[model samples]
Target: MCRRSSGYYAPTLAALALSATLGLAALSAPVAARWARTTSVAIGAGLLVLTAIPWWHGVTTKTPLREMPVHGNWALPGEYEKIGRKLGAAVEKAPVRSAGEVGALAYFCECQVVDKFSDRARLVERINDARERSWLYRLNYLMLDTDELERDRLKPDYWLDWRSGPNVGVGGWSTTGVYRGSGHFELRPDRPAHKPHPDDQGQLPSQASK
Candidate 1:
């Protein structure tokens, strides 16, 4: 796994954006204790209200793991753990290697796994993006490691295609399969999964040609 400063600072920046109202709410009087208490209580109350639905439903109705989405393209996250088992089985039973982007999907793929952040085929692209940006943004964006070693590029058996239109099955990669939004979109490979015609058994594990 590679560490990027963006991981830390992006959320910090978001938190700052969220508290922008504080800039507007600043008072002329000096009351540090009172001010802090009022803001804390407000934040707490807002949080409680946000959780009111799920908390109440869980306590009273006992909702299922697959939570119904409140709006578009939004659902419970981390279903990839369960779906990974299915993908692992599928690739083994099928004739293809693997490809994916989502960390959770990659994590549970049960393949000849490499560190996705370091060993990913796409690392060069991200590193290029980081390098292309101005130096000042480096501390808050994808960090660059000037001396980082580049891995050999290898294409996998399947190409994962993640859509963001609807939250359902991809049906298939193209023609027959309709592209829905993402739930397990990575599992929906762009091309049919297959190994080279003269399939070699001595190669890496089937699931991760990542």
Candidate 2:
């Protein structure tokens, strides 16, 4: 959200600047009053249109929501576990160096979590705890950090890409990314027993050991 002062003053400043330039032009020579008025009107209209285009585009475009492929029985590699554990430990450390520094780190950590975890419940729980002690701006950071952690753990062999757009019901917009495994992991036709399926009988799919 735009802060009150900047949002209120920017347009006013722009108008003042424009008016000052036009006044100087009028003072330099005996320009017709009609000509000065026309020029000012044209400049104001141009500025309005230029500023409104991005807002209009955002309202009109229906951005697509992209989903990453869910892998079956994906193993959390030792390296992933190592990194996750280290990050988790660091996050749990007591009393950051300063409130400002804590806030910044918390913000970054939340993004990492979201990029890693996505929508996992367990990870979300852990992130929620971490966020509680963080600054208010850092709340969303927790959700994002959990997402990142999950993504990294589930697909260690792949790279993910993201695109930005509006979010549903969330007022503001956000970026969503897709991730796929590299050649190191290929799709198996025989779906793993532990895989989450729409029509699974009561059987638990075999999970890969971390």
Candidate 3:
């Protein structure tokens, strides 16, 4: 289950700045002392209130956050959780590959989860892509975060193929095909060879798309 924000996690800098009100008021010209103190406290209060809205909404809405922008579709997150539990159960007492969706499966499956792309390597690669792009990508990334990504040579087996495509109707997501290795085969193995719908295409650009 996804946890709703209680706003306790929000930064309290504005609340902290409230402590400076008395000092700022005393240092100001006497005529403007009250004005400065009042304005400062009001602004800080406003920001604090603004930060509380998400928490209030969380208190109101019982809906679990559900979204999948990959294919512009919606789904209950439980669907994905179900798939994870199912996969874990299938490989009972053994380690299996995951899409690095989350840590819950790792705990439930009682196995070490490592499917590449989940660690610093992929982050470094994306940062490289950012360096070659506009400021938007570079905004939150630093080139010095890591040296060039050293490829992890550990080959994966029994890979999770939970991309958007044919849905087995188990979960809301399209078929989560467990392809051998990372071959990224596009055609649904259960179906005939044909171009997948534009939305169903989730293959990596470096690998075969169809």
- By lDDT, the best candidate is 3
Error of 2 at 31 (Å): 4.4
Ranking the candidates on TM-score from highest down gives: 3, 1, 2
What is the per-residue lDDT of model 1 for residues 85-199, given as tens digits with 9 covering 90 to 100? Answer: 5566666533223333334444566653333343444345444454466564356444544335344544455544444444445442211111234433444344534532212
> Local error of candidate 1 at 27, Å?
9.7
List ranges where model 1 is wrong by over 4 Å.
1-54, 68-82, 92-101, 112-121, 125-151, 162-210
RMSD of 2: 19.5
For each of the candidates, the C-alpha root-mean-square deviation to the true structure, in angstroms, is: 11.0, 19.5, 10.2
Q: Cα deviation of 143 in candidate 3 (Å)?
A: 22
lDDT of 2 by residue, 14-121 (tens): 878677666857665555666766676777787778657855664567233111123221122332333234433554432221111122223433323322123243
* TM-scores, one per candidate: 0.40, 0.28, 0.46
TM-score of 1: 0.40
The residue-by-residue lDDT of candidate 3 on 1-210, one tens digit each, is 222223433456545665566667667798887788678778778876876785566556744444321221122334445645665566554434444344544554455444444344434554566557757556655545545455542333344444444544542234232222112212121322333322133433333354
